[model samples]
Target: MIPVVPLDRSREAALRALVDGKAKPLGALGRIEDLAVRLALISGREDPSFDKALLLVFAGDHGLNQAGVSAYPSAVTTAMVATLLAGRASANAFARVVGAEVRVVDAGVAADLAPHPALVDAKVRRGTRNAASQPALTPDEVQSALARGAAVARRAVEAEGFDILAVGEMGIGNSASAALILHRLAPAPLADCIGLGAGHDAEGLARKHAVLAQAAARSDASDPPGVLAEFGGLEIIAMAGAILGAAAARTPVLVDGFIASTAALAAIRLEPAAADYCIFAHRSAEKGHALVLEAAGAEPLVDLSMRLGEGTGALLALPMVRAAAALLSEVASLDDVLAGRL
Candidate 1:
């Protein structure tokens, strides 16, 4: 088990110096400045470099399909997973632009996918049990999903030599699951955080809310693990574990949209120290996403009304993070340029 560490004063000092550098005014870069500083502190490097980027896309299926919450069928998860492996998905295009490596993990798709070179094949189950009717996953399944996610992160940090981890998910009706998780974890109402996932109509939205409310009633928010086991999707559970594992390994994490943000919240709930290593990539347009970000105390870097959950937003924010790091490491201090004390 990797040991998770708290942010120390040394790391904090490094961030302050980097942010207070000469070329740019203090806090001028806004959240991007804070993001680079946080990344530097987490990696324990004054001149932090993000040359290697690892994106782990967790694919799963939700049992809530029976509730008519999603316009697409559960099989879409498997199809999209395959698409991702083929490097044809939108995430692929974005990742290609950033020169990042993408890996798809079948956390628990409903379909049976044969062995593929591009897919990790870490399926935990066929699909989660319908949360509207019963618990989403058994305790064993939840544990397995988390273990797989942690192992993925460990591999990226240790074996693959990646410095940063970005999380993404592909699961039908996952937006409903994310909203439910956020509602349970936060002291907020379901209506506040729920959104029109995948462009659902009024009837679909109502059904989604009803199913989520039922699941929430059966959940125990005081017990986060139990809540996750009962109502969280396989992708969400895996993401939570990945976040925790990355923090334990001192790898900076760029948290994506709504689903990813909810997963980060779950991980932080399990271990508060995990938040120290995370950078909120963007403010998702999903109704509940902003509330989740607020609950996490995270100010995201971008807010372009993005509803995509495939780490696309995080990929967009990467250049800003790199620029901040470069400024801290390469830009000369004002005193050095002026050749005198200010």
Candidate 2:
């Protein structure tokens, strides 16, 4: 069965009526009003809760990182995952601010991460091979990564009962991979998909563009899996699977920045119905992210010039998701308003 069920539009009127009947005037809750209706429709429950949310950071290295496209070294991917595990990373700080537990998955980091409570050791391989010169992974390897990602989402929802999810990626050159995916899936121009990731210089940006164009020209993804295996990092693949898994369980998801949005695109490509389960958290300062967000049919909650991954963007938006639910359940109805029960 497809993971995401088609949203039941039959109930739209009743749901919106409920939102409109809230104590405040119509649209007073603004986007949260829309958020409330959408969540109710997606979950098939008028009074759903955003009480629990899970954050997944899928970390990996990219062969394309060796091509000098990113300003950060590939080693930063593994190092940052270490910081995530230590709970001292920026993601953790925001996670605390937003109320969530963090889980780091070693999707395919080049370095070996020691066992940690917060880490899911689901490494597909050391890292992806250089896509500029070769295929990123075997088709079989791609499926493995996808399954690992889906399994994590399942555990979060089924075992832990998380009602919402956020998927993020950590990979140095994955931005190039994301661009390639958006170029293929979004079918945007190579230039439109290209961006100055991690602040590349003029020469670096030019070289980055040249390499991504070459990679795009050389590779073609025939299907969702093909698109992912051809250009996506392990972390990206896992994130896509997590999205699909969450959608399958009727759990809402907050998509993070460029790479995470690309993963969400892949998930939707695999199953278009998954889009109903996603909420874009924020726009990234990184280039090409807007195009990807457009392709995903998402309007982010904020634009804070945030480009850091590790699920921070979505975590920052967690309150909005929760607030929508809170308002829906806590506020008095218009009937109560008319009855002078406020």
Q: Residues 117-195, candidate 1, lDDT per residue (tens digit)?
A: 7678778888888988798888888888888888889888999899888889899889988888888786478889789
lDDT of 2 by residue, 1-342 (tens): 236786878999988988998888789778889898888887787777887878999999999988987888999988888888899998899888888989998999999889999999899999998888888989899888888898899889999988899888788888888888888888788899888777788999999998888787787665777777788689998899899888888889999999899999888888899999889999999889999888888899899999988788999999988888877778889899899997
lDDT of 1 at 274: 88
Stretches off by above 4 angstroms in model 2 are: none
C-alpha TM-scores of all predictions: 0.95, 0.97
Clashes of 1: 0
Model 2 lDDT vs. the true structure? Answer: 0.87
After superposing candidate 1, which stretches have Cα over 4 Å from the reference? 1-3, 340-342
Q: Among all windows of ten consecutive residues in candidate 2, which has the lowest summed lDDT?
A: 1-10
Cα deviation of 146, candidate 1, in Å: 1.2
How many backbone clashes does every candidate have? Answer: 0, 1
